[model samples]
Target: MHNIVLFGPPGAGKGTQSQKLIAQYNLVHLSTGDLLRAQITEGTALGLKAKKLMDEGLLVPDEVVIGMIGSALSANQQAAGFIFDGFPRTTAQAESLDRLLAEHHTKVACMIALEVGEEELVKRLLERGKTSGRPDDQDETKIRRRVTVYNTETAQVAGYYAAQHKFHALNGIGNIDDIFAQICLLIDQHKPAVDEAPAAATREVKA
Candidate 1:
């Protein structure tokens, strides 16, 4: 499977890029925000609990987030792969995900970290707010807080995966298509080699 994580801070265009990746690669997109939103729309218990935290601008707890992700994975095991847009924001969440995927015999093939300057991110976020009217982008304070929280919480997970040799940093400043091309290139370069021992053995059999 080609499971991967699209990692980045808020306003890093992760959502936009993930959509492109899903369309181009035919991978399942597992976005934590979408998962929670679905639960909230369906009035699931976990959705109600997460809604409380989100209403207060507080992050949903790790256990709650993990549960949402687990449910998504179980449902998508037959998919070609998954592109995790906004999950595993903490070390604990990362560890839980590792264990969960291990149980399913799937590992993350890569983590593409969309790198952008804070000033640029803030600018884009403010512009998005003007156009999108998202509550989180309504005020500078909330936008800044979201970025701060992302850095404090999610940045470490980048390092954690980097140490595992699965992290690839992609420049996120450019046209949407341009940025996506960078990500595709990185994935191409980092993709693990296919098992060739069997091919070699087949050649020996032919000989």
Candidate 2:
């Protein structure tokens, strides 16, 4: 089972890219925000707890996030793979993901980090505020806080994965298709070689 992570700052188009990647690669797209919102909307037990924390402006606990992801993964075992959009932000969550995927006999194949300038991120987020209707997104102060938290808390995981040779950074300023193409190239490079093609080519050349 192939597993991938798309890491980027807010407004870097991670969600946009993830949707394209899922369609092109047949991978399941797992967005933590979507999952949590669904849980809350459904009034699940975890959702109730998460809603309380969110209502109070507190981050949801890691265990709750992990449980949600674990449930998603198990239910989608028949998927081609999974593309995690915003789940494993902290190192603890990252490690937990590693363990959970291992238990399922799968592993993270790549972590695609979309690099964008902070100024641009702030600009995009502010514009997003006008349309998102999310209280956190609508508040500039809260948006900045999320960015700061991501830099301090989540950015470190990029280096952690890089040390393990699983990190790939892509410039995120171009057109949506351009960024998606870059990611597609990386995934192609990581895919195992097809033996059938090599064998056929060898025979044709011999003839």
Candidate 3:
């Protein structure tokens, strides 16, 4: 299995790139943000708890997030691998994810972080906000706060993966296809090779 963590702050084009990677790699895309929203939309017990915390502007607990991921993994047993997005925001969460993947006989092959300048990120997010209808993206103050929160709190997760020699950084600028090509190169390097088919048997006829 060639599991990957697609790491980036807001407006780093993770969503766009993830789609391409999923198509090229045949990997399951697991976005915690999407998973939480699905649960909430379905009114699951876990979703209710998450909704309460989110309604209060508080972050959901890591265990809850881990549980959601576990369920996602269970649901996609035939997947070639997974592209994890918007997850493992802290070192603790990273450790938890490692354990979870180990239970399935796989480990994170690499974590590819999209490095973008704050100015560019701000500009992209503000422009997206015009059409995204996302309140957090629309307000400059919220955008800055989100970036600050990522830097101060979430950026350390990179170190967790780095210590395991699974962290890689990519410049997240210029043409989309160009960036994707670079990303594909890196993934191909880290992804495990597929098993070769067994040689056909040669039969000896008895006279």
Best by TM-score: 3
**What would the per-residue lDDT of candidate 2 be over residues 1-207, giving only the tens digit for each residue?**
556888888888987887787777677777888888888888888899999999999999988888788878776666667788776877788899998888776778888888888778888988888898877877778877877877776577887788878889889898999888899999877664431111111100000
Looking at model 3, report the run of 10 residues with the lowest lDDT sum: 198-207
Evaluation by lDDT, superior candidate among 2 and 3: 3
The clash count of every prediction, one per candidate, is 0, 0, 0
lDDT score, candidate 3, position 111: 92
Q: Model 3: which residue pairs collide?
A: none
The local distance difference test score of model 1 is 0.76
User: Model 2 segments beyond 4 Å from truth?
Assistant: 43-45, 48-58, 135-139, 192-207
TM-score of each: 0.81, 0.81, 0.88
Can you give the lDDT of residue 108 in candidate 1?
Answer: 82
Given candidate 1, what's the lDDT at residue 63? 86
lDDT agreement of model 3 with the native? 0.82
Error of 1 at 2 (Å): 1.0
lDDT of each: 0.76, 0.77, 0.82
* Winning candidate number (lDDT): 3
Residue pairs clashing in model 2 are none
TM-score of candidate 2 versus the correct structure, residues matched by position: 0.81
